[model samples]
Target: MSSTTRTTCQSECLCDCNRPGAACQDPRFVGGGDGITFYFHGKKGQDFCIVSDSNLRINARFIGKRNQNMKRDFTWVQSLGILFDTHNLFIGAKNTSIWEDSNDRLSLGFNGEPIHLLDGEGTKWESMTSPSVTITRLLDTNSVEVEVEGNFKIKATVVPITEKDSRVHNYGITQEDCFSHLDLSFKFYALSGQVNGVLGQTYASNYVSKVKMGVVMPVLGGEKEFSSSSLFGTDCAVARFSGQFTEGNSLENLEYGNLNCSSGMNGRGVVCKR
Candidate 1:
């Protein structure tokens, strides 16, 4: 058994929730590649697109509880479904009634097959199929990094909403469940200017944030535009995925050796040349 901690975007990567292109507590997102933070309160038990580009798609399933005092549910990202070049990857936090720091609660699957990694920090697994992908454990348990060469890197950590959180935010967390969720940070290597989704749109060259800035907590509204029928669906109104791979596609043509990378506040690092 691995014990759980309260993972925050700030602790995981170079770019965190306070910076840009990260998603954290209660579903706050920092996007626009300009550090504009906003809240996207997609309905509980629903799936929403976080990134939808021509060659890549990422969706999140939200889980939450309702408070009679509030008009909407208090939600958190429960899992991530990633689709790329005909492959599907799933990462999620397994539901637990009690959290222990030494107990592992992370669940992962690649192409519909369960992924089991040896319990140890720095343990890694790489895909055996085409289009190389890898997952590395950043800690002994509950924290890992998923990376697809020439595509994207995602850091996901499983966390729980503590009783202190419930008391402070009135989350009403009960003994039955602590509402484990994910704290995530992303780094995209070759996103197109036409990319669209909650976080993907901010990477577009012509993106203009719809969030109302300068507020303590800005909320982004567009549930219908970002909603998907399922965790792996790419049918959001603003989706740009074609769901088809052809010869000479960007994934096949990307120069793996010529990439120029630089550290930035937007993501893990900026790929100057892709």
Candidate 2:
């Protein structure tokens, strides 16, 4: 069974890592509804649930390097696996030895098939299946917007660790791999009050944070609760997914040419105006 709801395009609906309800560099997360910031350092090479609603489930795969001086690994979100209804979408950054902004490192897959788009801004791909999904390139390379109609929209940008970052953070990054990763922003239209996950809990009406405030680096520790078996798994302890399609599953007829997209401040994300 399928459900439908009407949704509009609004600016405030966008949620970037710099804003509330985002997970960005080093896996730092800003609350969904609350204005709290915290870090979740799940084990390296592990997958964890970031968002789990009644109909939508999103998991992130962490990639990291063990710092010789630090106790824990320094992790970043390397890829995302999104499950809605019976479809699966995968977005990831391919590892590269030499970082080049001119080359595309963003990798995309739907269901089990690879997705390829043209090399230009405004290039897009639309799924022919029900619960329409659209992926649009916001830049000439390595930046895209994945929208599931009224359900949600995710803006993903592929990035690499710079030499300065490695030097300052003591990442011990080598020339073998640049460790390409993603910086993501999200916008969700219809989410249930029962939503739960690393970022989803903040959307609950009765949610209360347990994170310590006024600290140098407030961290949210729930590795067991948010751990998933795989990138596409919805078996996390706080998972609320039912593997069913909910309301607002229709496709929007957006004019790609009308989209005005620009890099956010500090080149953090892509902001689009319709």
Candidate 3:
């Protein structure tokens, strides 16, 4: 362990490696151009605060990986992933069938209109405000598109990959700890005043699941959607996006094509079809 203890063990994995103070994984700046990043999840790895940034980006996980597959984690029965927000995308899932609906399925998109909040949709849209995420436009809306599953007809964009430009914290997010206590509560967002939750907003603290824990998000990196691929192919293709061109957030001139992802019995998502 030379070279100054290997740069103090990657600055103690960006400050504070034994779990203490001042090393919340280093990027705590939070302003325009954005900051805040932390991860070390799954299987008793603990420490979470996925992200909250400018142009918006967050992850508990829908994070996929199939090509060059050295490693990647966190899909956690789908729970609390705020989305690549620029024009809007919010997701939360976890109700595989506690007799069909034990309540925990909130999916969203406004500029690409497709909001599905299963389990009584929060008591029929209790607090989704912004006229309940309203945005409507279609004159063939440039001939709307959707198609997925290897025959990937892609016009794909999943916005907000922050952390001063993430690569997924250069391999430091492992996944585990949705035993519930993120204190994530979002209401009425169309642009919820440009939500600077750093990347996904769950900033409340006083965690007590594993007997006292503290880590205030910083040092995150993770790739996105298509290019840098995390190709999903188990339940197969169902990509969804509604409408946003002149300004939805980020994603300009994206295109890819190959088709065969319109399945039956309704049990697949991430769809795009025309």
Model 1 lDDT, full chain set: 0.77
List the candidate 3 regions with Cα displacement exceeding 4 Å. 1-53, 61-77, 83-90, 95-129, 132-250, 259-274
For each candidate, what TM-score against the reference? Answer: 0.85, 0.83, 0.24
Q: Taking the tens digit of each residue's C-alpha lDDT, what string does model 1 give over 24-137?
A: 778877673555666888889999999998888999999999989989898999999999988999999999878875778899999999999887889999988854899999
Superior by lDDT: candidate 1 or candidate 3: 1
lDDT of 2 by residue, 71-142 (tens): 888898999999987889999999887786678899999999999888998898999875479999887888
Q: Give the per-residue lDDT of model 3 (tens digit) for 1-274.
A: 0111112221211222222111111212111111121332232121223333332333333332222333534322133333332333433332221111122223444445565433321123222443323221111111111221111111111112122212333322222211111112121122222222223232212221211113232223322221111111111011222222124543222222232223221111211121
Number of the predicted model whose lDDT against the real structure is largest:
1
Off by over 4 Å in 1: 1-4, 7-9, 12-15, 243-274
Worst 10 residues of 2 by lDDT: 1-10
Ranking by lDDT: 1, 2, 3
The candidate that wins on TM-score is 1
Pairs clashing within candidate 2: 5-248, 21-31
Ranking by TM-score: 1, 2, 3
The TM-score of predicted model 2 comes to: 0.83
